[model samples]
Target chain A: MSPIASNDGMRPWRLLRAALCVFVAVCLLSPLVVVLIISFSSAPFLQFPPPGLSLRWYMLLFSTPAWMNSLLVSVELLVPSSILATIMGTAAAYALVRGRVPGAPFIMACLMLPIVVPGMITAAALFGVYRGLGLNGTLTGLIIGHTVLNLPYVVATVASALRVQDARLELAAATLGAPPWATFRRITLPLVLPAVLSSLLIAMILSFDELIVSLFVSSARVRPVAVQMWSNLMGDFDPTIAAIASVCFLFAFLVLLADLALRAGRSLRLT
Target chain B: MRPIDRRIWLLLPATLLLTVAFLGPVGWLLARAFTFPQPGFQNFELLWQRPVYLRVMGNTLLISAIVTPIVVLLGFPVAHMMAHGSARLRRWLVFLVLVPFWTSLLVRSFATAILLQRHGVINSFLIGFGFIDEPLPLLYNLTGLLAGCVQVLLPFVIFPLYSAMARIDPALMKAAATLGAPPLRAFVRVYLPLTLPGVMTGATLVFISTLGYYIIPALLGGARQQMVAQLIQDQIATFGNWGVAGALSLVLLLATGVLLALLQLTVGLKEIAR
Candidate 1:
């Protein structure tokens, strides 16, 4: 590292740099912090530095069927889609990494199309196709849509991990009289398991947070929390949404914290 | 032929799933865009001839253009700090970045609504402090839309830029300094040029994502300020005009394709997966 670029050197510049960093960080984080505070407000409306602390909104959120049902719907879709995406993604990653699949690059690009294309386009297209297939507004449709949306992340993560892994182990196992399935199960799968799990978790998060596609594909019978939140924001302004935001914030935080813990543990094992 | 390659079989399930579930729908939409409503490029003609359709497209591009530079300007310093800081500081900075990065986009948009509304935090503070006699119009406008977009895209810019900057040797800067160049000159001449790839990558990613963004623009940008996504949704949801919607989607798909191709050339295909 350059001494001039070091934090210890150039006092005024360092101070300015430190201030800008803190300012930007605070600016980025302020909204979430404000939402957390507002969720606790006893007042009926969104009041900042809220009137007083209470779990009234949270209680209200749980008591309301629409909000609670939406939450349940989101979880239902999140779990199935995450699992489906993970399985497909892990398989695709394996093929791309080790399989003698022709046109691996083209296949990888196609897999990533969902990530690159605008989501509204996907949602609209699915809306039309599902209308014909009688799948629109069904939970299965949402799951399929979400699984496609999430497949890329899982594939990328697992594929990157597989790229760095030593293939010699799989070769050795096969040479030592292990069948293909046995070699994969005992050697290849075990090594990439952590990344596969990470991809699953990340896929779950993506499904949970998805809004635009869900807005298009979901019906009143199968609305996700994000769709519910969108309708709620448009129709009314209330702290109940704040309460819901806080619940989501907490859910996302816990999942991310778990992901971090998993990563840290894996790194420690490697070291 | 002891055993067929398992890899080929492994790819089959995903390929089947994507084809049936994912590509099938998109392909159907593309087909409908051509044939729907007794159509023969009428939808495309509508997009080309209509003033409102053109306006939304222009608005989407304008907002992205405005947001990209601001995000880069704000992201550069933080990324610089993260790249060059001590390990402990780097850890803290990464946490600060990742928390927002991982936070739900819906939650972030809602927070922006709460913070930028007429009586929201910023306006309320300004009024209370007597800085303004009346609340300034912030929400449901371009300002609110930009705020939401920038926050969402900032981390995208920072991470790529930081990665690129980190790869550069500090010794080059030190050498420039030793050769009697001033600090600013060294940065502008040596350090800046080296980090150009990162800046290009971050800027392009932010722009492309912004162009495709739906939720923030839909929620924070109110009915008055319609964007391309909103227009497409309106075509389908309100008008039930699938042909027009499909046509609009094709336009967006084409734009995204071109930009992504550019990204591939500049940042490499591997950088995109990350």
Candidate 2:
């Protein structure tokens, strides 16, 4: 198709359109740019275009006990929850994809219930149950809650990957005298490992950033970084949070990069 | 056991986890709503009975309605540009959208706070330029809340629409032009209808998510502008009223279900998910 030629009469209209596009792009990206700028500011108060630059806020984030402890709690919660979610998710996805379970669509939707339901309801509900079970204000409770939230991601990714896999490979392994577990371990797992890993990274990102559930399930002793950040935001407009926010950005970015690299490697292997 | 039967065991672990952690808890909350504060439908009735709760419900709907169209209007041009731009430009534009999409909600809301605060970036810049005599009340208002939400949700709208728009056959527009249709008329007739699925998808997503949003409004909106999620939080966290909170949640859930069903009826559920 020939490109639509901008006639002489349309030149001003085209120029205006380009200007509008540029303005919209700037507006959309400004907040992220502003966060980065404020993160490096030396000002104790939230200020744009810092009068001076210093790494002290970043340093302070790591050195302060409250922030540092929350970070440790976050990582502690993130690792266990992601691992748990990935494991459960992989198994459930395999069953759904390969087992040919009846009503799989409905079951998949049921599993995704956490995603659709508002976080406030989930948080409050978990608060009530955890209180009953003596799991409230505990790291285990946080891990369990986060795992439930993360399970759907892993299941979705791995189930899709499983959909594209050849069942014949597993059958071939079974025909070669391998047990069911052996067939899965030797053939199936390796094929789907990349999707599983990608889901794991996503689960980690979600767990690290999760706040509402953590607010309800966690105590002062087991606070996640996001919960801590939320309180700090509510209590005071702390600029140090800008440094912590930057760190959160770095974590999310790294996980995304890892996910991309995994997908790329999978594609390369396929080709 | 049969092969399928044995394989069903694979789902057990996850089912067990979900049953204990998720389903059980939410069920408990709903059960408590009926039984805790003298039972029956009193709590549900309170939703309609109380002016505050009704106002919050209205506020939630109003914000979602406002934010959805704003995001769609603002996002249409960018998505259009991305669909039509050069490969390099498309990548950069997609990156611009993705960075915010993946960035922490807390950070974005915080950034919005800085920009919307009395002496924050936008205000200060405007003041420095002598655009205003005094700092405007941007934060702690609906304007600030909308600013935070539209930015956060814009990418969600743009992406689905961009995918749909990119698949459009540009030749159809050229054909319309060859038939003596004006450019504007051709675009309106040919391109717009084709992108309806994307528009519906993005609008439904932005609206549904906006209904449940808590952080942005909590941080930016005025005390009077409390949304449903905040109302639920207040009932639980502030008032410690599980009964009313659960009732409020049910209202929100019903609203969400209706929206999803409406979208599903128009565009298949799978398309919207995509």
lDDT of candidates 1 onward, in order: 0.87, 0.87
CAPRI accuracy category, model 1: medium
**How do the residues B1-274 of candidate 1 rate in per-residue lDDT, one tens digit apiece?**
2344757888887888889878988887777778889859898888889899998999888998999999998899899999998999899898899888888999999998999988899999999999999999988888999999999898998998898889888789888888988787888999998888788888988998988888888878866568888888889889999888888878888887888788778778675444
Candidate 1 runs further than 4 Å off: A1-13, B1-4, B271-274
DockQ, Cα level, model 1 = 0.65
TM-score, model 1, chain B versus true chain B = 0.95
Q: After superposition, how far is residue B15 of candidate 1 from its true place, in Å?
A: 1.1
**Could you give the interface RMSD of each candidate, to one decimal?**
1.9, 2.1
Per-residue lDDT tens digits for candidate 1, residues A1-271, read 4555554436777778788788789878999999999999999889887889999998999999999899999999999999999999998899888987778899998998888888888898889888988988999999999999999999989998888788998999989999988988999888888888898989988999999889989999899999999899888779999989988888888888888887887677667
TM-score of each: 0.96, 0.95
- lDDT by residue for model 2 (A1-271), tens: 2545444544675676678678767776787778778888888888887888888888888889999999999999999999999999999999988886877788888888888888888998999888878999999889999999999899999998898889999989889999999999989999999999999998999999888899888888889899899999997786688889888988887777787789989888777
